[model samples]
Target: MLLETSIGAVIRYKSPVSSKEPEFLILKNRRGSWGFPQGHKEHGESELETLKREVREETGIQFLEIMSFIGTIRYSYMKLNGIRSHKEVKFYFATTPIRDIVISYEHASYRWVSFLSGLNFLAHRQLKSILIKGHRTGLY
Candidate 1:
């Protein structure tokens, strides 16, 4: 039995030139499911470091101020190799000033949407709950 862990951020930002309303950044993966930027942890990497690297790799935006640790979610899935793995993801509430997004090869597209919109776009119940927890943190 093997367990894997990943880290991610519920990134919030408001355009300095546009309206003051905050928007959450969501990425569309190649499978068409939408979620926040995240990736597996590397050797000797802290959760925050993994999150920052994942965000920078998945979305070109960087220099995010980590506000709070939202929470963690765990689930199990079968990989393509027919091995079952348990995965846990730790999410943080982060804010950034950059509005422009340059998606990486891991994702198909990206969107900066309102809180409600982000909740609607998220496919996983855990992720939706994470977004709501992030909202309560007042980071947005």
Candidate 2:
């Protein structure tokens, strides 16, 4: 059975954040939708390890450090067999590697948009809450 687990970061730059510069970086998918960079946990890897790996794989950058936890979200989706499986995703507030970046192929484009822009792109209401709370706390 595949129990899917993943992690994401709200990556912020070292520069003073601008309302126009966006507090969050979002990856645009093939579907024309946007989401955070995340990937599956590999064997023997810790959660943080997976988060870093996934972010780098998806966005071509590293996180200097994790500033805070943004909690987790879980939901279920069905496979071809019609048996539903659950995905639990952990999220964190992270600082970037102190360099500008380009994205990898998994995403067609990227945006460093404001919290409101990010919220507009994020498809899930629950993840939006996490992002909002993380922003309010100024965790990054």
Candidate 3:
């Protein structure tokens, strides 16, 4: 068994004037599955640095105000080469005012959705649990 670690964020956006609930950013991958922006940590990069870079690369939203680390999610899958691997994803709660996005080739589309909508959009139970933990942080 192999272990892999990645960093990601649940990016929240709220209009300063609208007084509405904060919307979360979700990316639809080429496979048509939705998830947050995340990637493997690069050499010599800290967790936060990796998370920031992943967010910018995927969403083109650079001004991330990282609120706090919510929690970690773990899952297992088999790689293309038939190797079983366990992955751990550390998720942070972040906020950004920018709404415009230039999605990278990795994703087919993107959306800014309400908390409940995000929960509905995500298929993995672990991801939904993480989102709920982030929402419970009282920052939004």
Candidate 4:
């Protein structure tokens, strides 16, 4: 079995004129599944560094303020080579003012949605729970 670790941000931003809460930025992968902007960690990189690089690479937004470390999620999946792999992802609460996003080729689309809408858009139970926790803790 192989273990991999990654880092990501639960990115949120406030609308200037809207009275609603800050919206979260979610990305839709080529497979049509929606989730946060994340990727695998590179060599000699810290978790925060990995998150910053991944977010910039995936979203094309460079400015961000990391608020807090949300938590970590773990799961297992089978690799293409018939190897079982365990993956761990550490998530951070981050904020940005840029609304327009330019996604990388890896994602099919992007959305800046409210907390509830984001929860509804996400298909993974673990990700939904992470959003719930971030909401309950008032990280947004």
lDDT of each: 0.89, 0.78, 0.91, 0.92
Ranking by lDDT: 4, 3, 1, 2
- Supply the TM-score for candidate 2: 0.84
State the local distance difference test value for candidate 4.
0.92
Candidate 4 residue-wise lDDT, 1-140, digit = tens: 79999998899985676686779999999999999998899999988899999999999988999999998999999999999999999999998888999999999999999888998999999999889989899776
Better of 2 and 4 by lDDT: 4
What does candidate 2's lDDT look like per residue over 1-140, in tens digits? Answer: 45798887778765654443545678888877777877788899998888888887877785457777888888888988988889988988887735466788777888887777888888878778878888787674
TM-scores across all candidates?
0.94, 0.84, 0.96, 0.96
Please tell me which model should have the higher TM-score, number 1 or number 3. Answer: 3
Pick out the ten consecutive residues of candidate 4 with the lowest summed lDDT: 13-22
Better of 1 and 3 by lDDT: 3
Stretches > 4 Å off in candidate 4: none
Tens-digit per-residue lDDT, 21-75, candidate 3: 7799999999899999999999999999999899999989889999898999999
How does residue 65 of candidate 4 score in lDDT?
91
By summed lDDT, which 10 consecutive residues of candidate 2 come out lowest?
Answer: 14-23
Q: Candidate 3 has what TM-score? A: 0.96
